[model samples]
Target: MNVLLVKDDCGRSRKTCHMPTHTAIIALTKGGKQLAQRLKTLVPGSEIIPNKGKIHQTFAQAWQDHDSLICIMATGIVVRSIAPLLQDKTVDPALVVCDEQGRFAVSLLSGHLGGGNALAQKVADVLGGQAVITTASDVLGHTALDLWCRDMGLAVTDKQGLTRVMAKLVNTGSVTLYSEYPLPPLPQDIIPSRTLDAADLLVTSRIRQKENIVLLHPKALVAGIGCNRNTPAKEISEALDHACRTHQLARESVRNLASIDLKSDEPGLLAFAHAQNLPLDFYSPDQLNQVEGVAASAAVLRATGAKAVAEPAAILSSGGGPLLVQKMKFPNVTVAIAEILQPFPTLF
Candidate 1:
């Protein structure tokens, strides 16, 4: 949790300045020294970076580095500094604004906008301050549809589109969710208005519903793995992380865990497959032989007792191809990640 703190117009370090992990404090006045000392007492491991110039420079630098912003300055200064950064969707970080006294913490931008609201609450709790959360669903104690989609590892293709849908949901007190399979149970307070069949949904899920409904697709990211017998679970986990980052795919989107049948019972693969909460599908030797363009090594073939030389390639094709491949040296394993591409119907 990286935080960026800015000084207020009064040019004073509030006694409430406490640092957490990966914290950076930027001040427009010389007051940063006092804040840094207080932060060191609160968070020994925190890093405090001070600037006594314009607030916008600090904001721009923080934005460029993609750090979450926690403004301890005036509300107007915080607002002005963040306005430009908000326009570009790709670079925005969670933005939280707190008074110099730290009595009230407000989530001004990225409130469910980009996870700022949740971060604000967490920061407020740490400081023993009041979190002035304004997101309507959160204030009403209703399940937030966008947050739900994020939790399910589904991407929200259009933010404005989701906004419109949420507005409808707020007014109607009803929204539909579509899925090809039965969804995991939702909060009991949420009642389904109706279930209709339509091809358009905001997120990934096999189910479809009529207008004014939210759709949750099953996991769309597939993990195709090839591991050695009795491989360590840590190696497999690291391989999965590497592959996911290499492919620029969210770890949460991983829907299916796949491997060769010979290694299905391997403890490492089994544990990793289960931990991700995805279905583990094993491919038989014959099935491994069927995938085209697979590069198998003699060592892999002999170790797995498979007729084919490349177990990783087979796993990818079986799981779905154009997969991200990660070769492990310790356990002599390889992992692949594939992103499911689904066609969505236009919702007018």
Candidate 2:
């Protein structure tokens, strides 16, 4: 895939396969234009959209091009211009409204998951103003569930359930929390539940279909794989999928792939990893030998100088974590899975 060069907040160049618009600032009046220009310099990776006199047309053009939009116009004007382009909150860009005098930055749309509140605060900081955030959780000084999921890289299973749980959090100021892995410090509003049945929010790799519960799947599993030479990519993918399904694991939680260095250039493994957008790590035979308690195969030892490939590689990639799935063999593939145990974000 072709790559693009992007600049970060520190003005450092980074390579990316896709170039998403970082930020776009649009303004109408002269004072608003001046504020937009100042923000272009203050906010990293931000650019001012040239106003062509037709403010609605400019907003329409920017709505599809940017991940974040800062409108230096009246809040009503912004709402009207973006109404037609509005879609699901998950897909909509961060919308922030700032006064022409740079007195206040309002998080008008997509505040939690879209990061509009953070952007508003940043703009206010740069302009010496105050940020107006109206989210119920933020106003009540409680941890926003959606923002927590975003920061922890969790995938919510049910959107409507999450909304209901957020409302419950704001109304009652507490929700039961359950996790399969260790967690960071909990706030007063998050009461830990000992069982999944009694929990209102769950963090696990298991699939659940119950209602009135917000389920979040963490990217915590590492799949180690070994395949016969010249195996097809489709076969390898199906083998992994079968393994995950058989073990009742969520496919979204498989973080990466691990294999021996001898198969580093294997076309099947490379293609599967690329299609899944998962990182692939390779280890030497000596490193694999260091991992004990794995099923040793004489044929694998003779061919690759390692007694086991899939099980040890999974353990190594997971930072020496215990295996969740022991080695399973298919016609042309061997697979193992391990939970990645590491430090989580303590900010929550």
lDDT of 2 at 170: 93
lDDT of 1 at 125: 73
Candidate 2 segments whose C-alpha is farther than 4 A from its true place: 1-21, 52-61, 209-211, 228-236, 265-277, 298-303, 330-333, 341-348
Q: After superposition, how far is residue 245 of candidate 1 from its true place, in Å?
A: 22
Cα lDDT of model 2 by residue, 65-88, tens digit = 888999998999998888888887
Please report, as a residue range, the 10-residue window in candidate 2 with the lowest summed lDDT: 10-19
Candidate 1 error regions (>4 Å): 1-23, 29-46, 88-91, 188-194, 198-215, 221-348
Pairs in steric clash, model 1: 179-207, 180-206, 180-207, 204-217, 205-216, 205-217, 205-218, 296-309, 296-310, 297-309
* Shift in Å, residue 341, candidate 1: 17
Tens digits of per-residue lDDT for model 1, 160-207:
667776665577665555444334565544443334453224344222
Instruction: Name the lDDT of candidate 1.
Output: 0.57
Model 2 TM: 0.84
TM-score for each predicted model, relative to the true structure: 0.56, 0.84
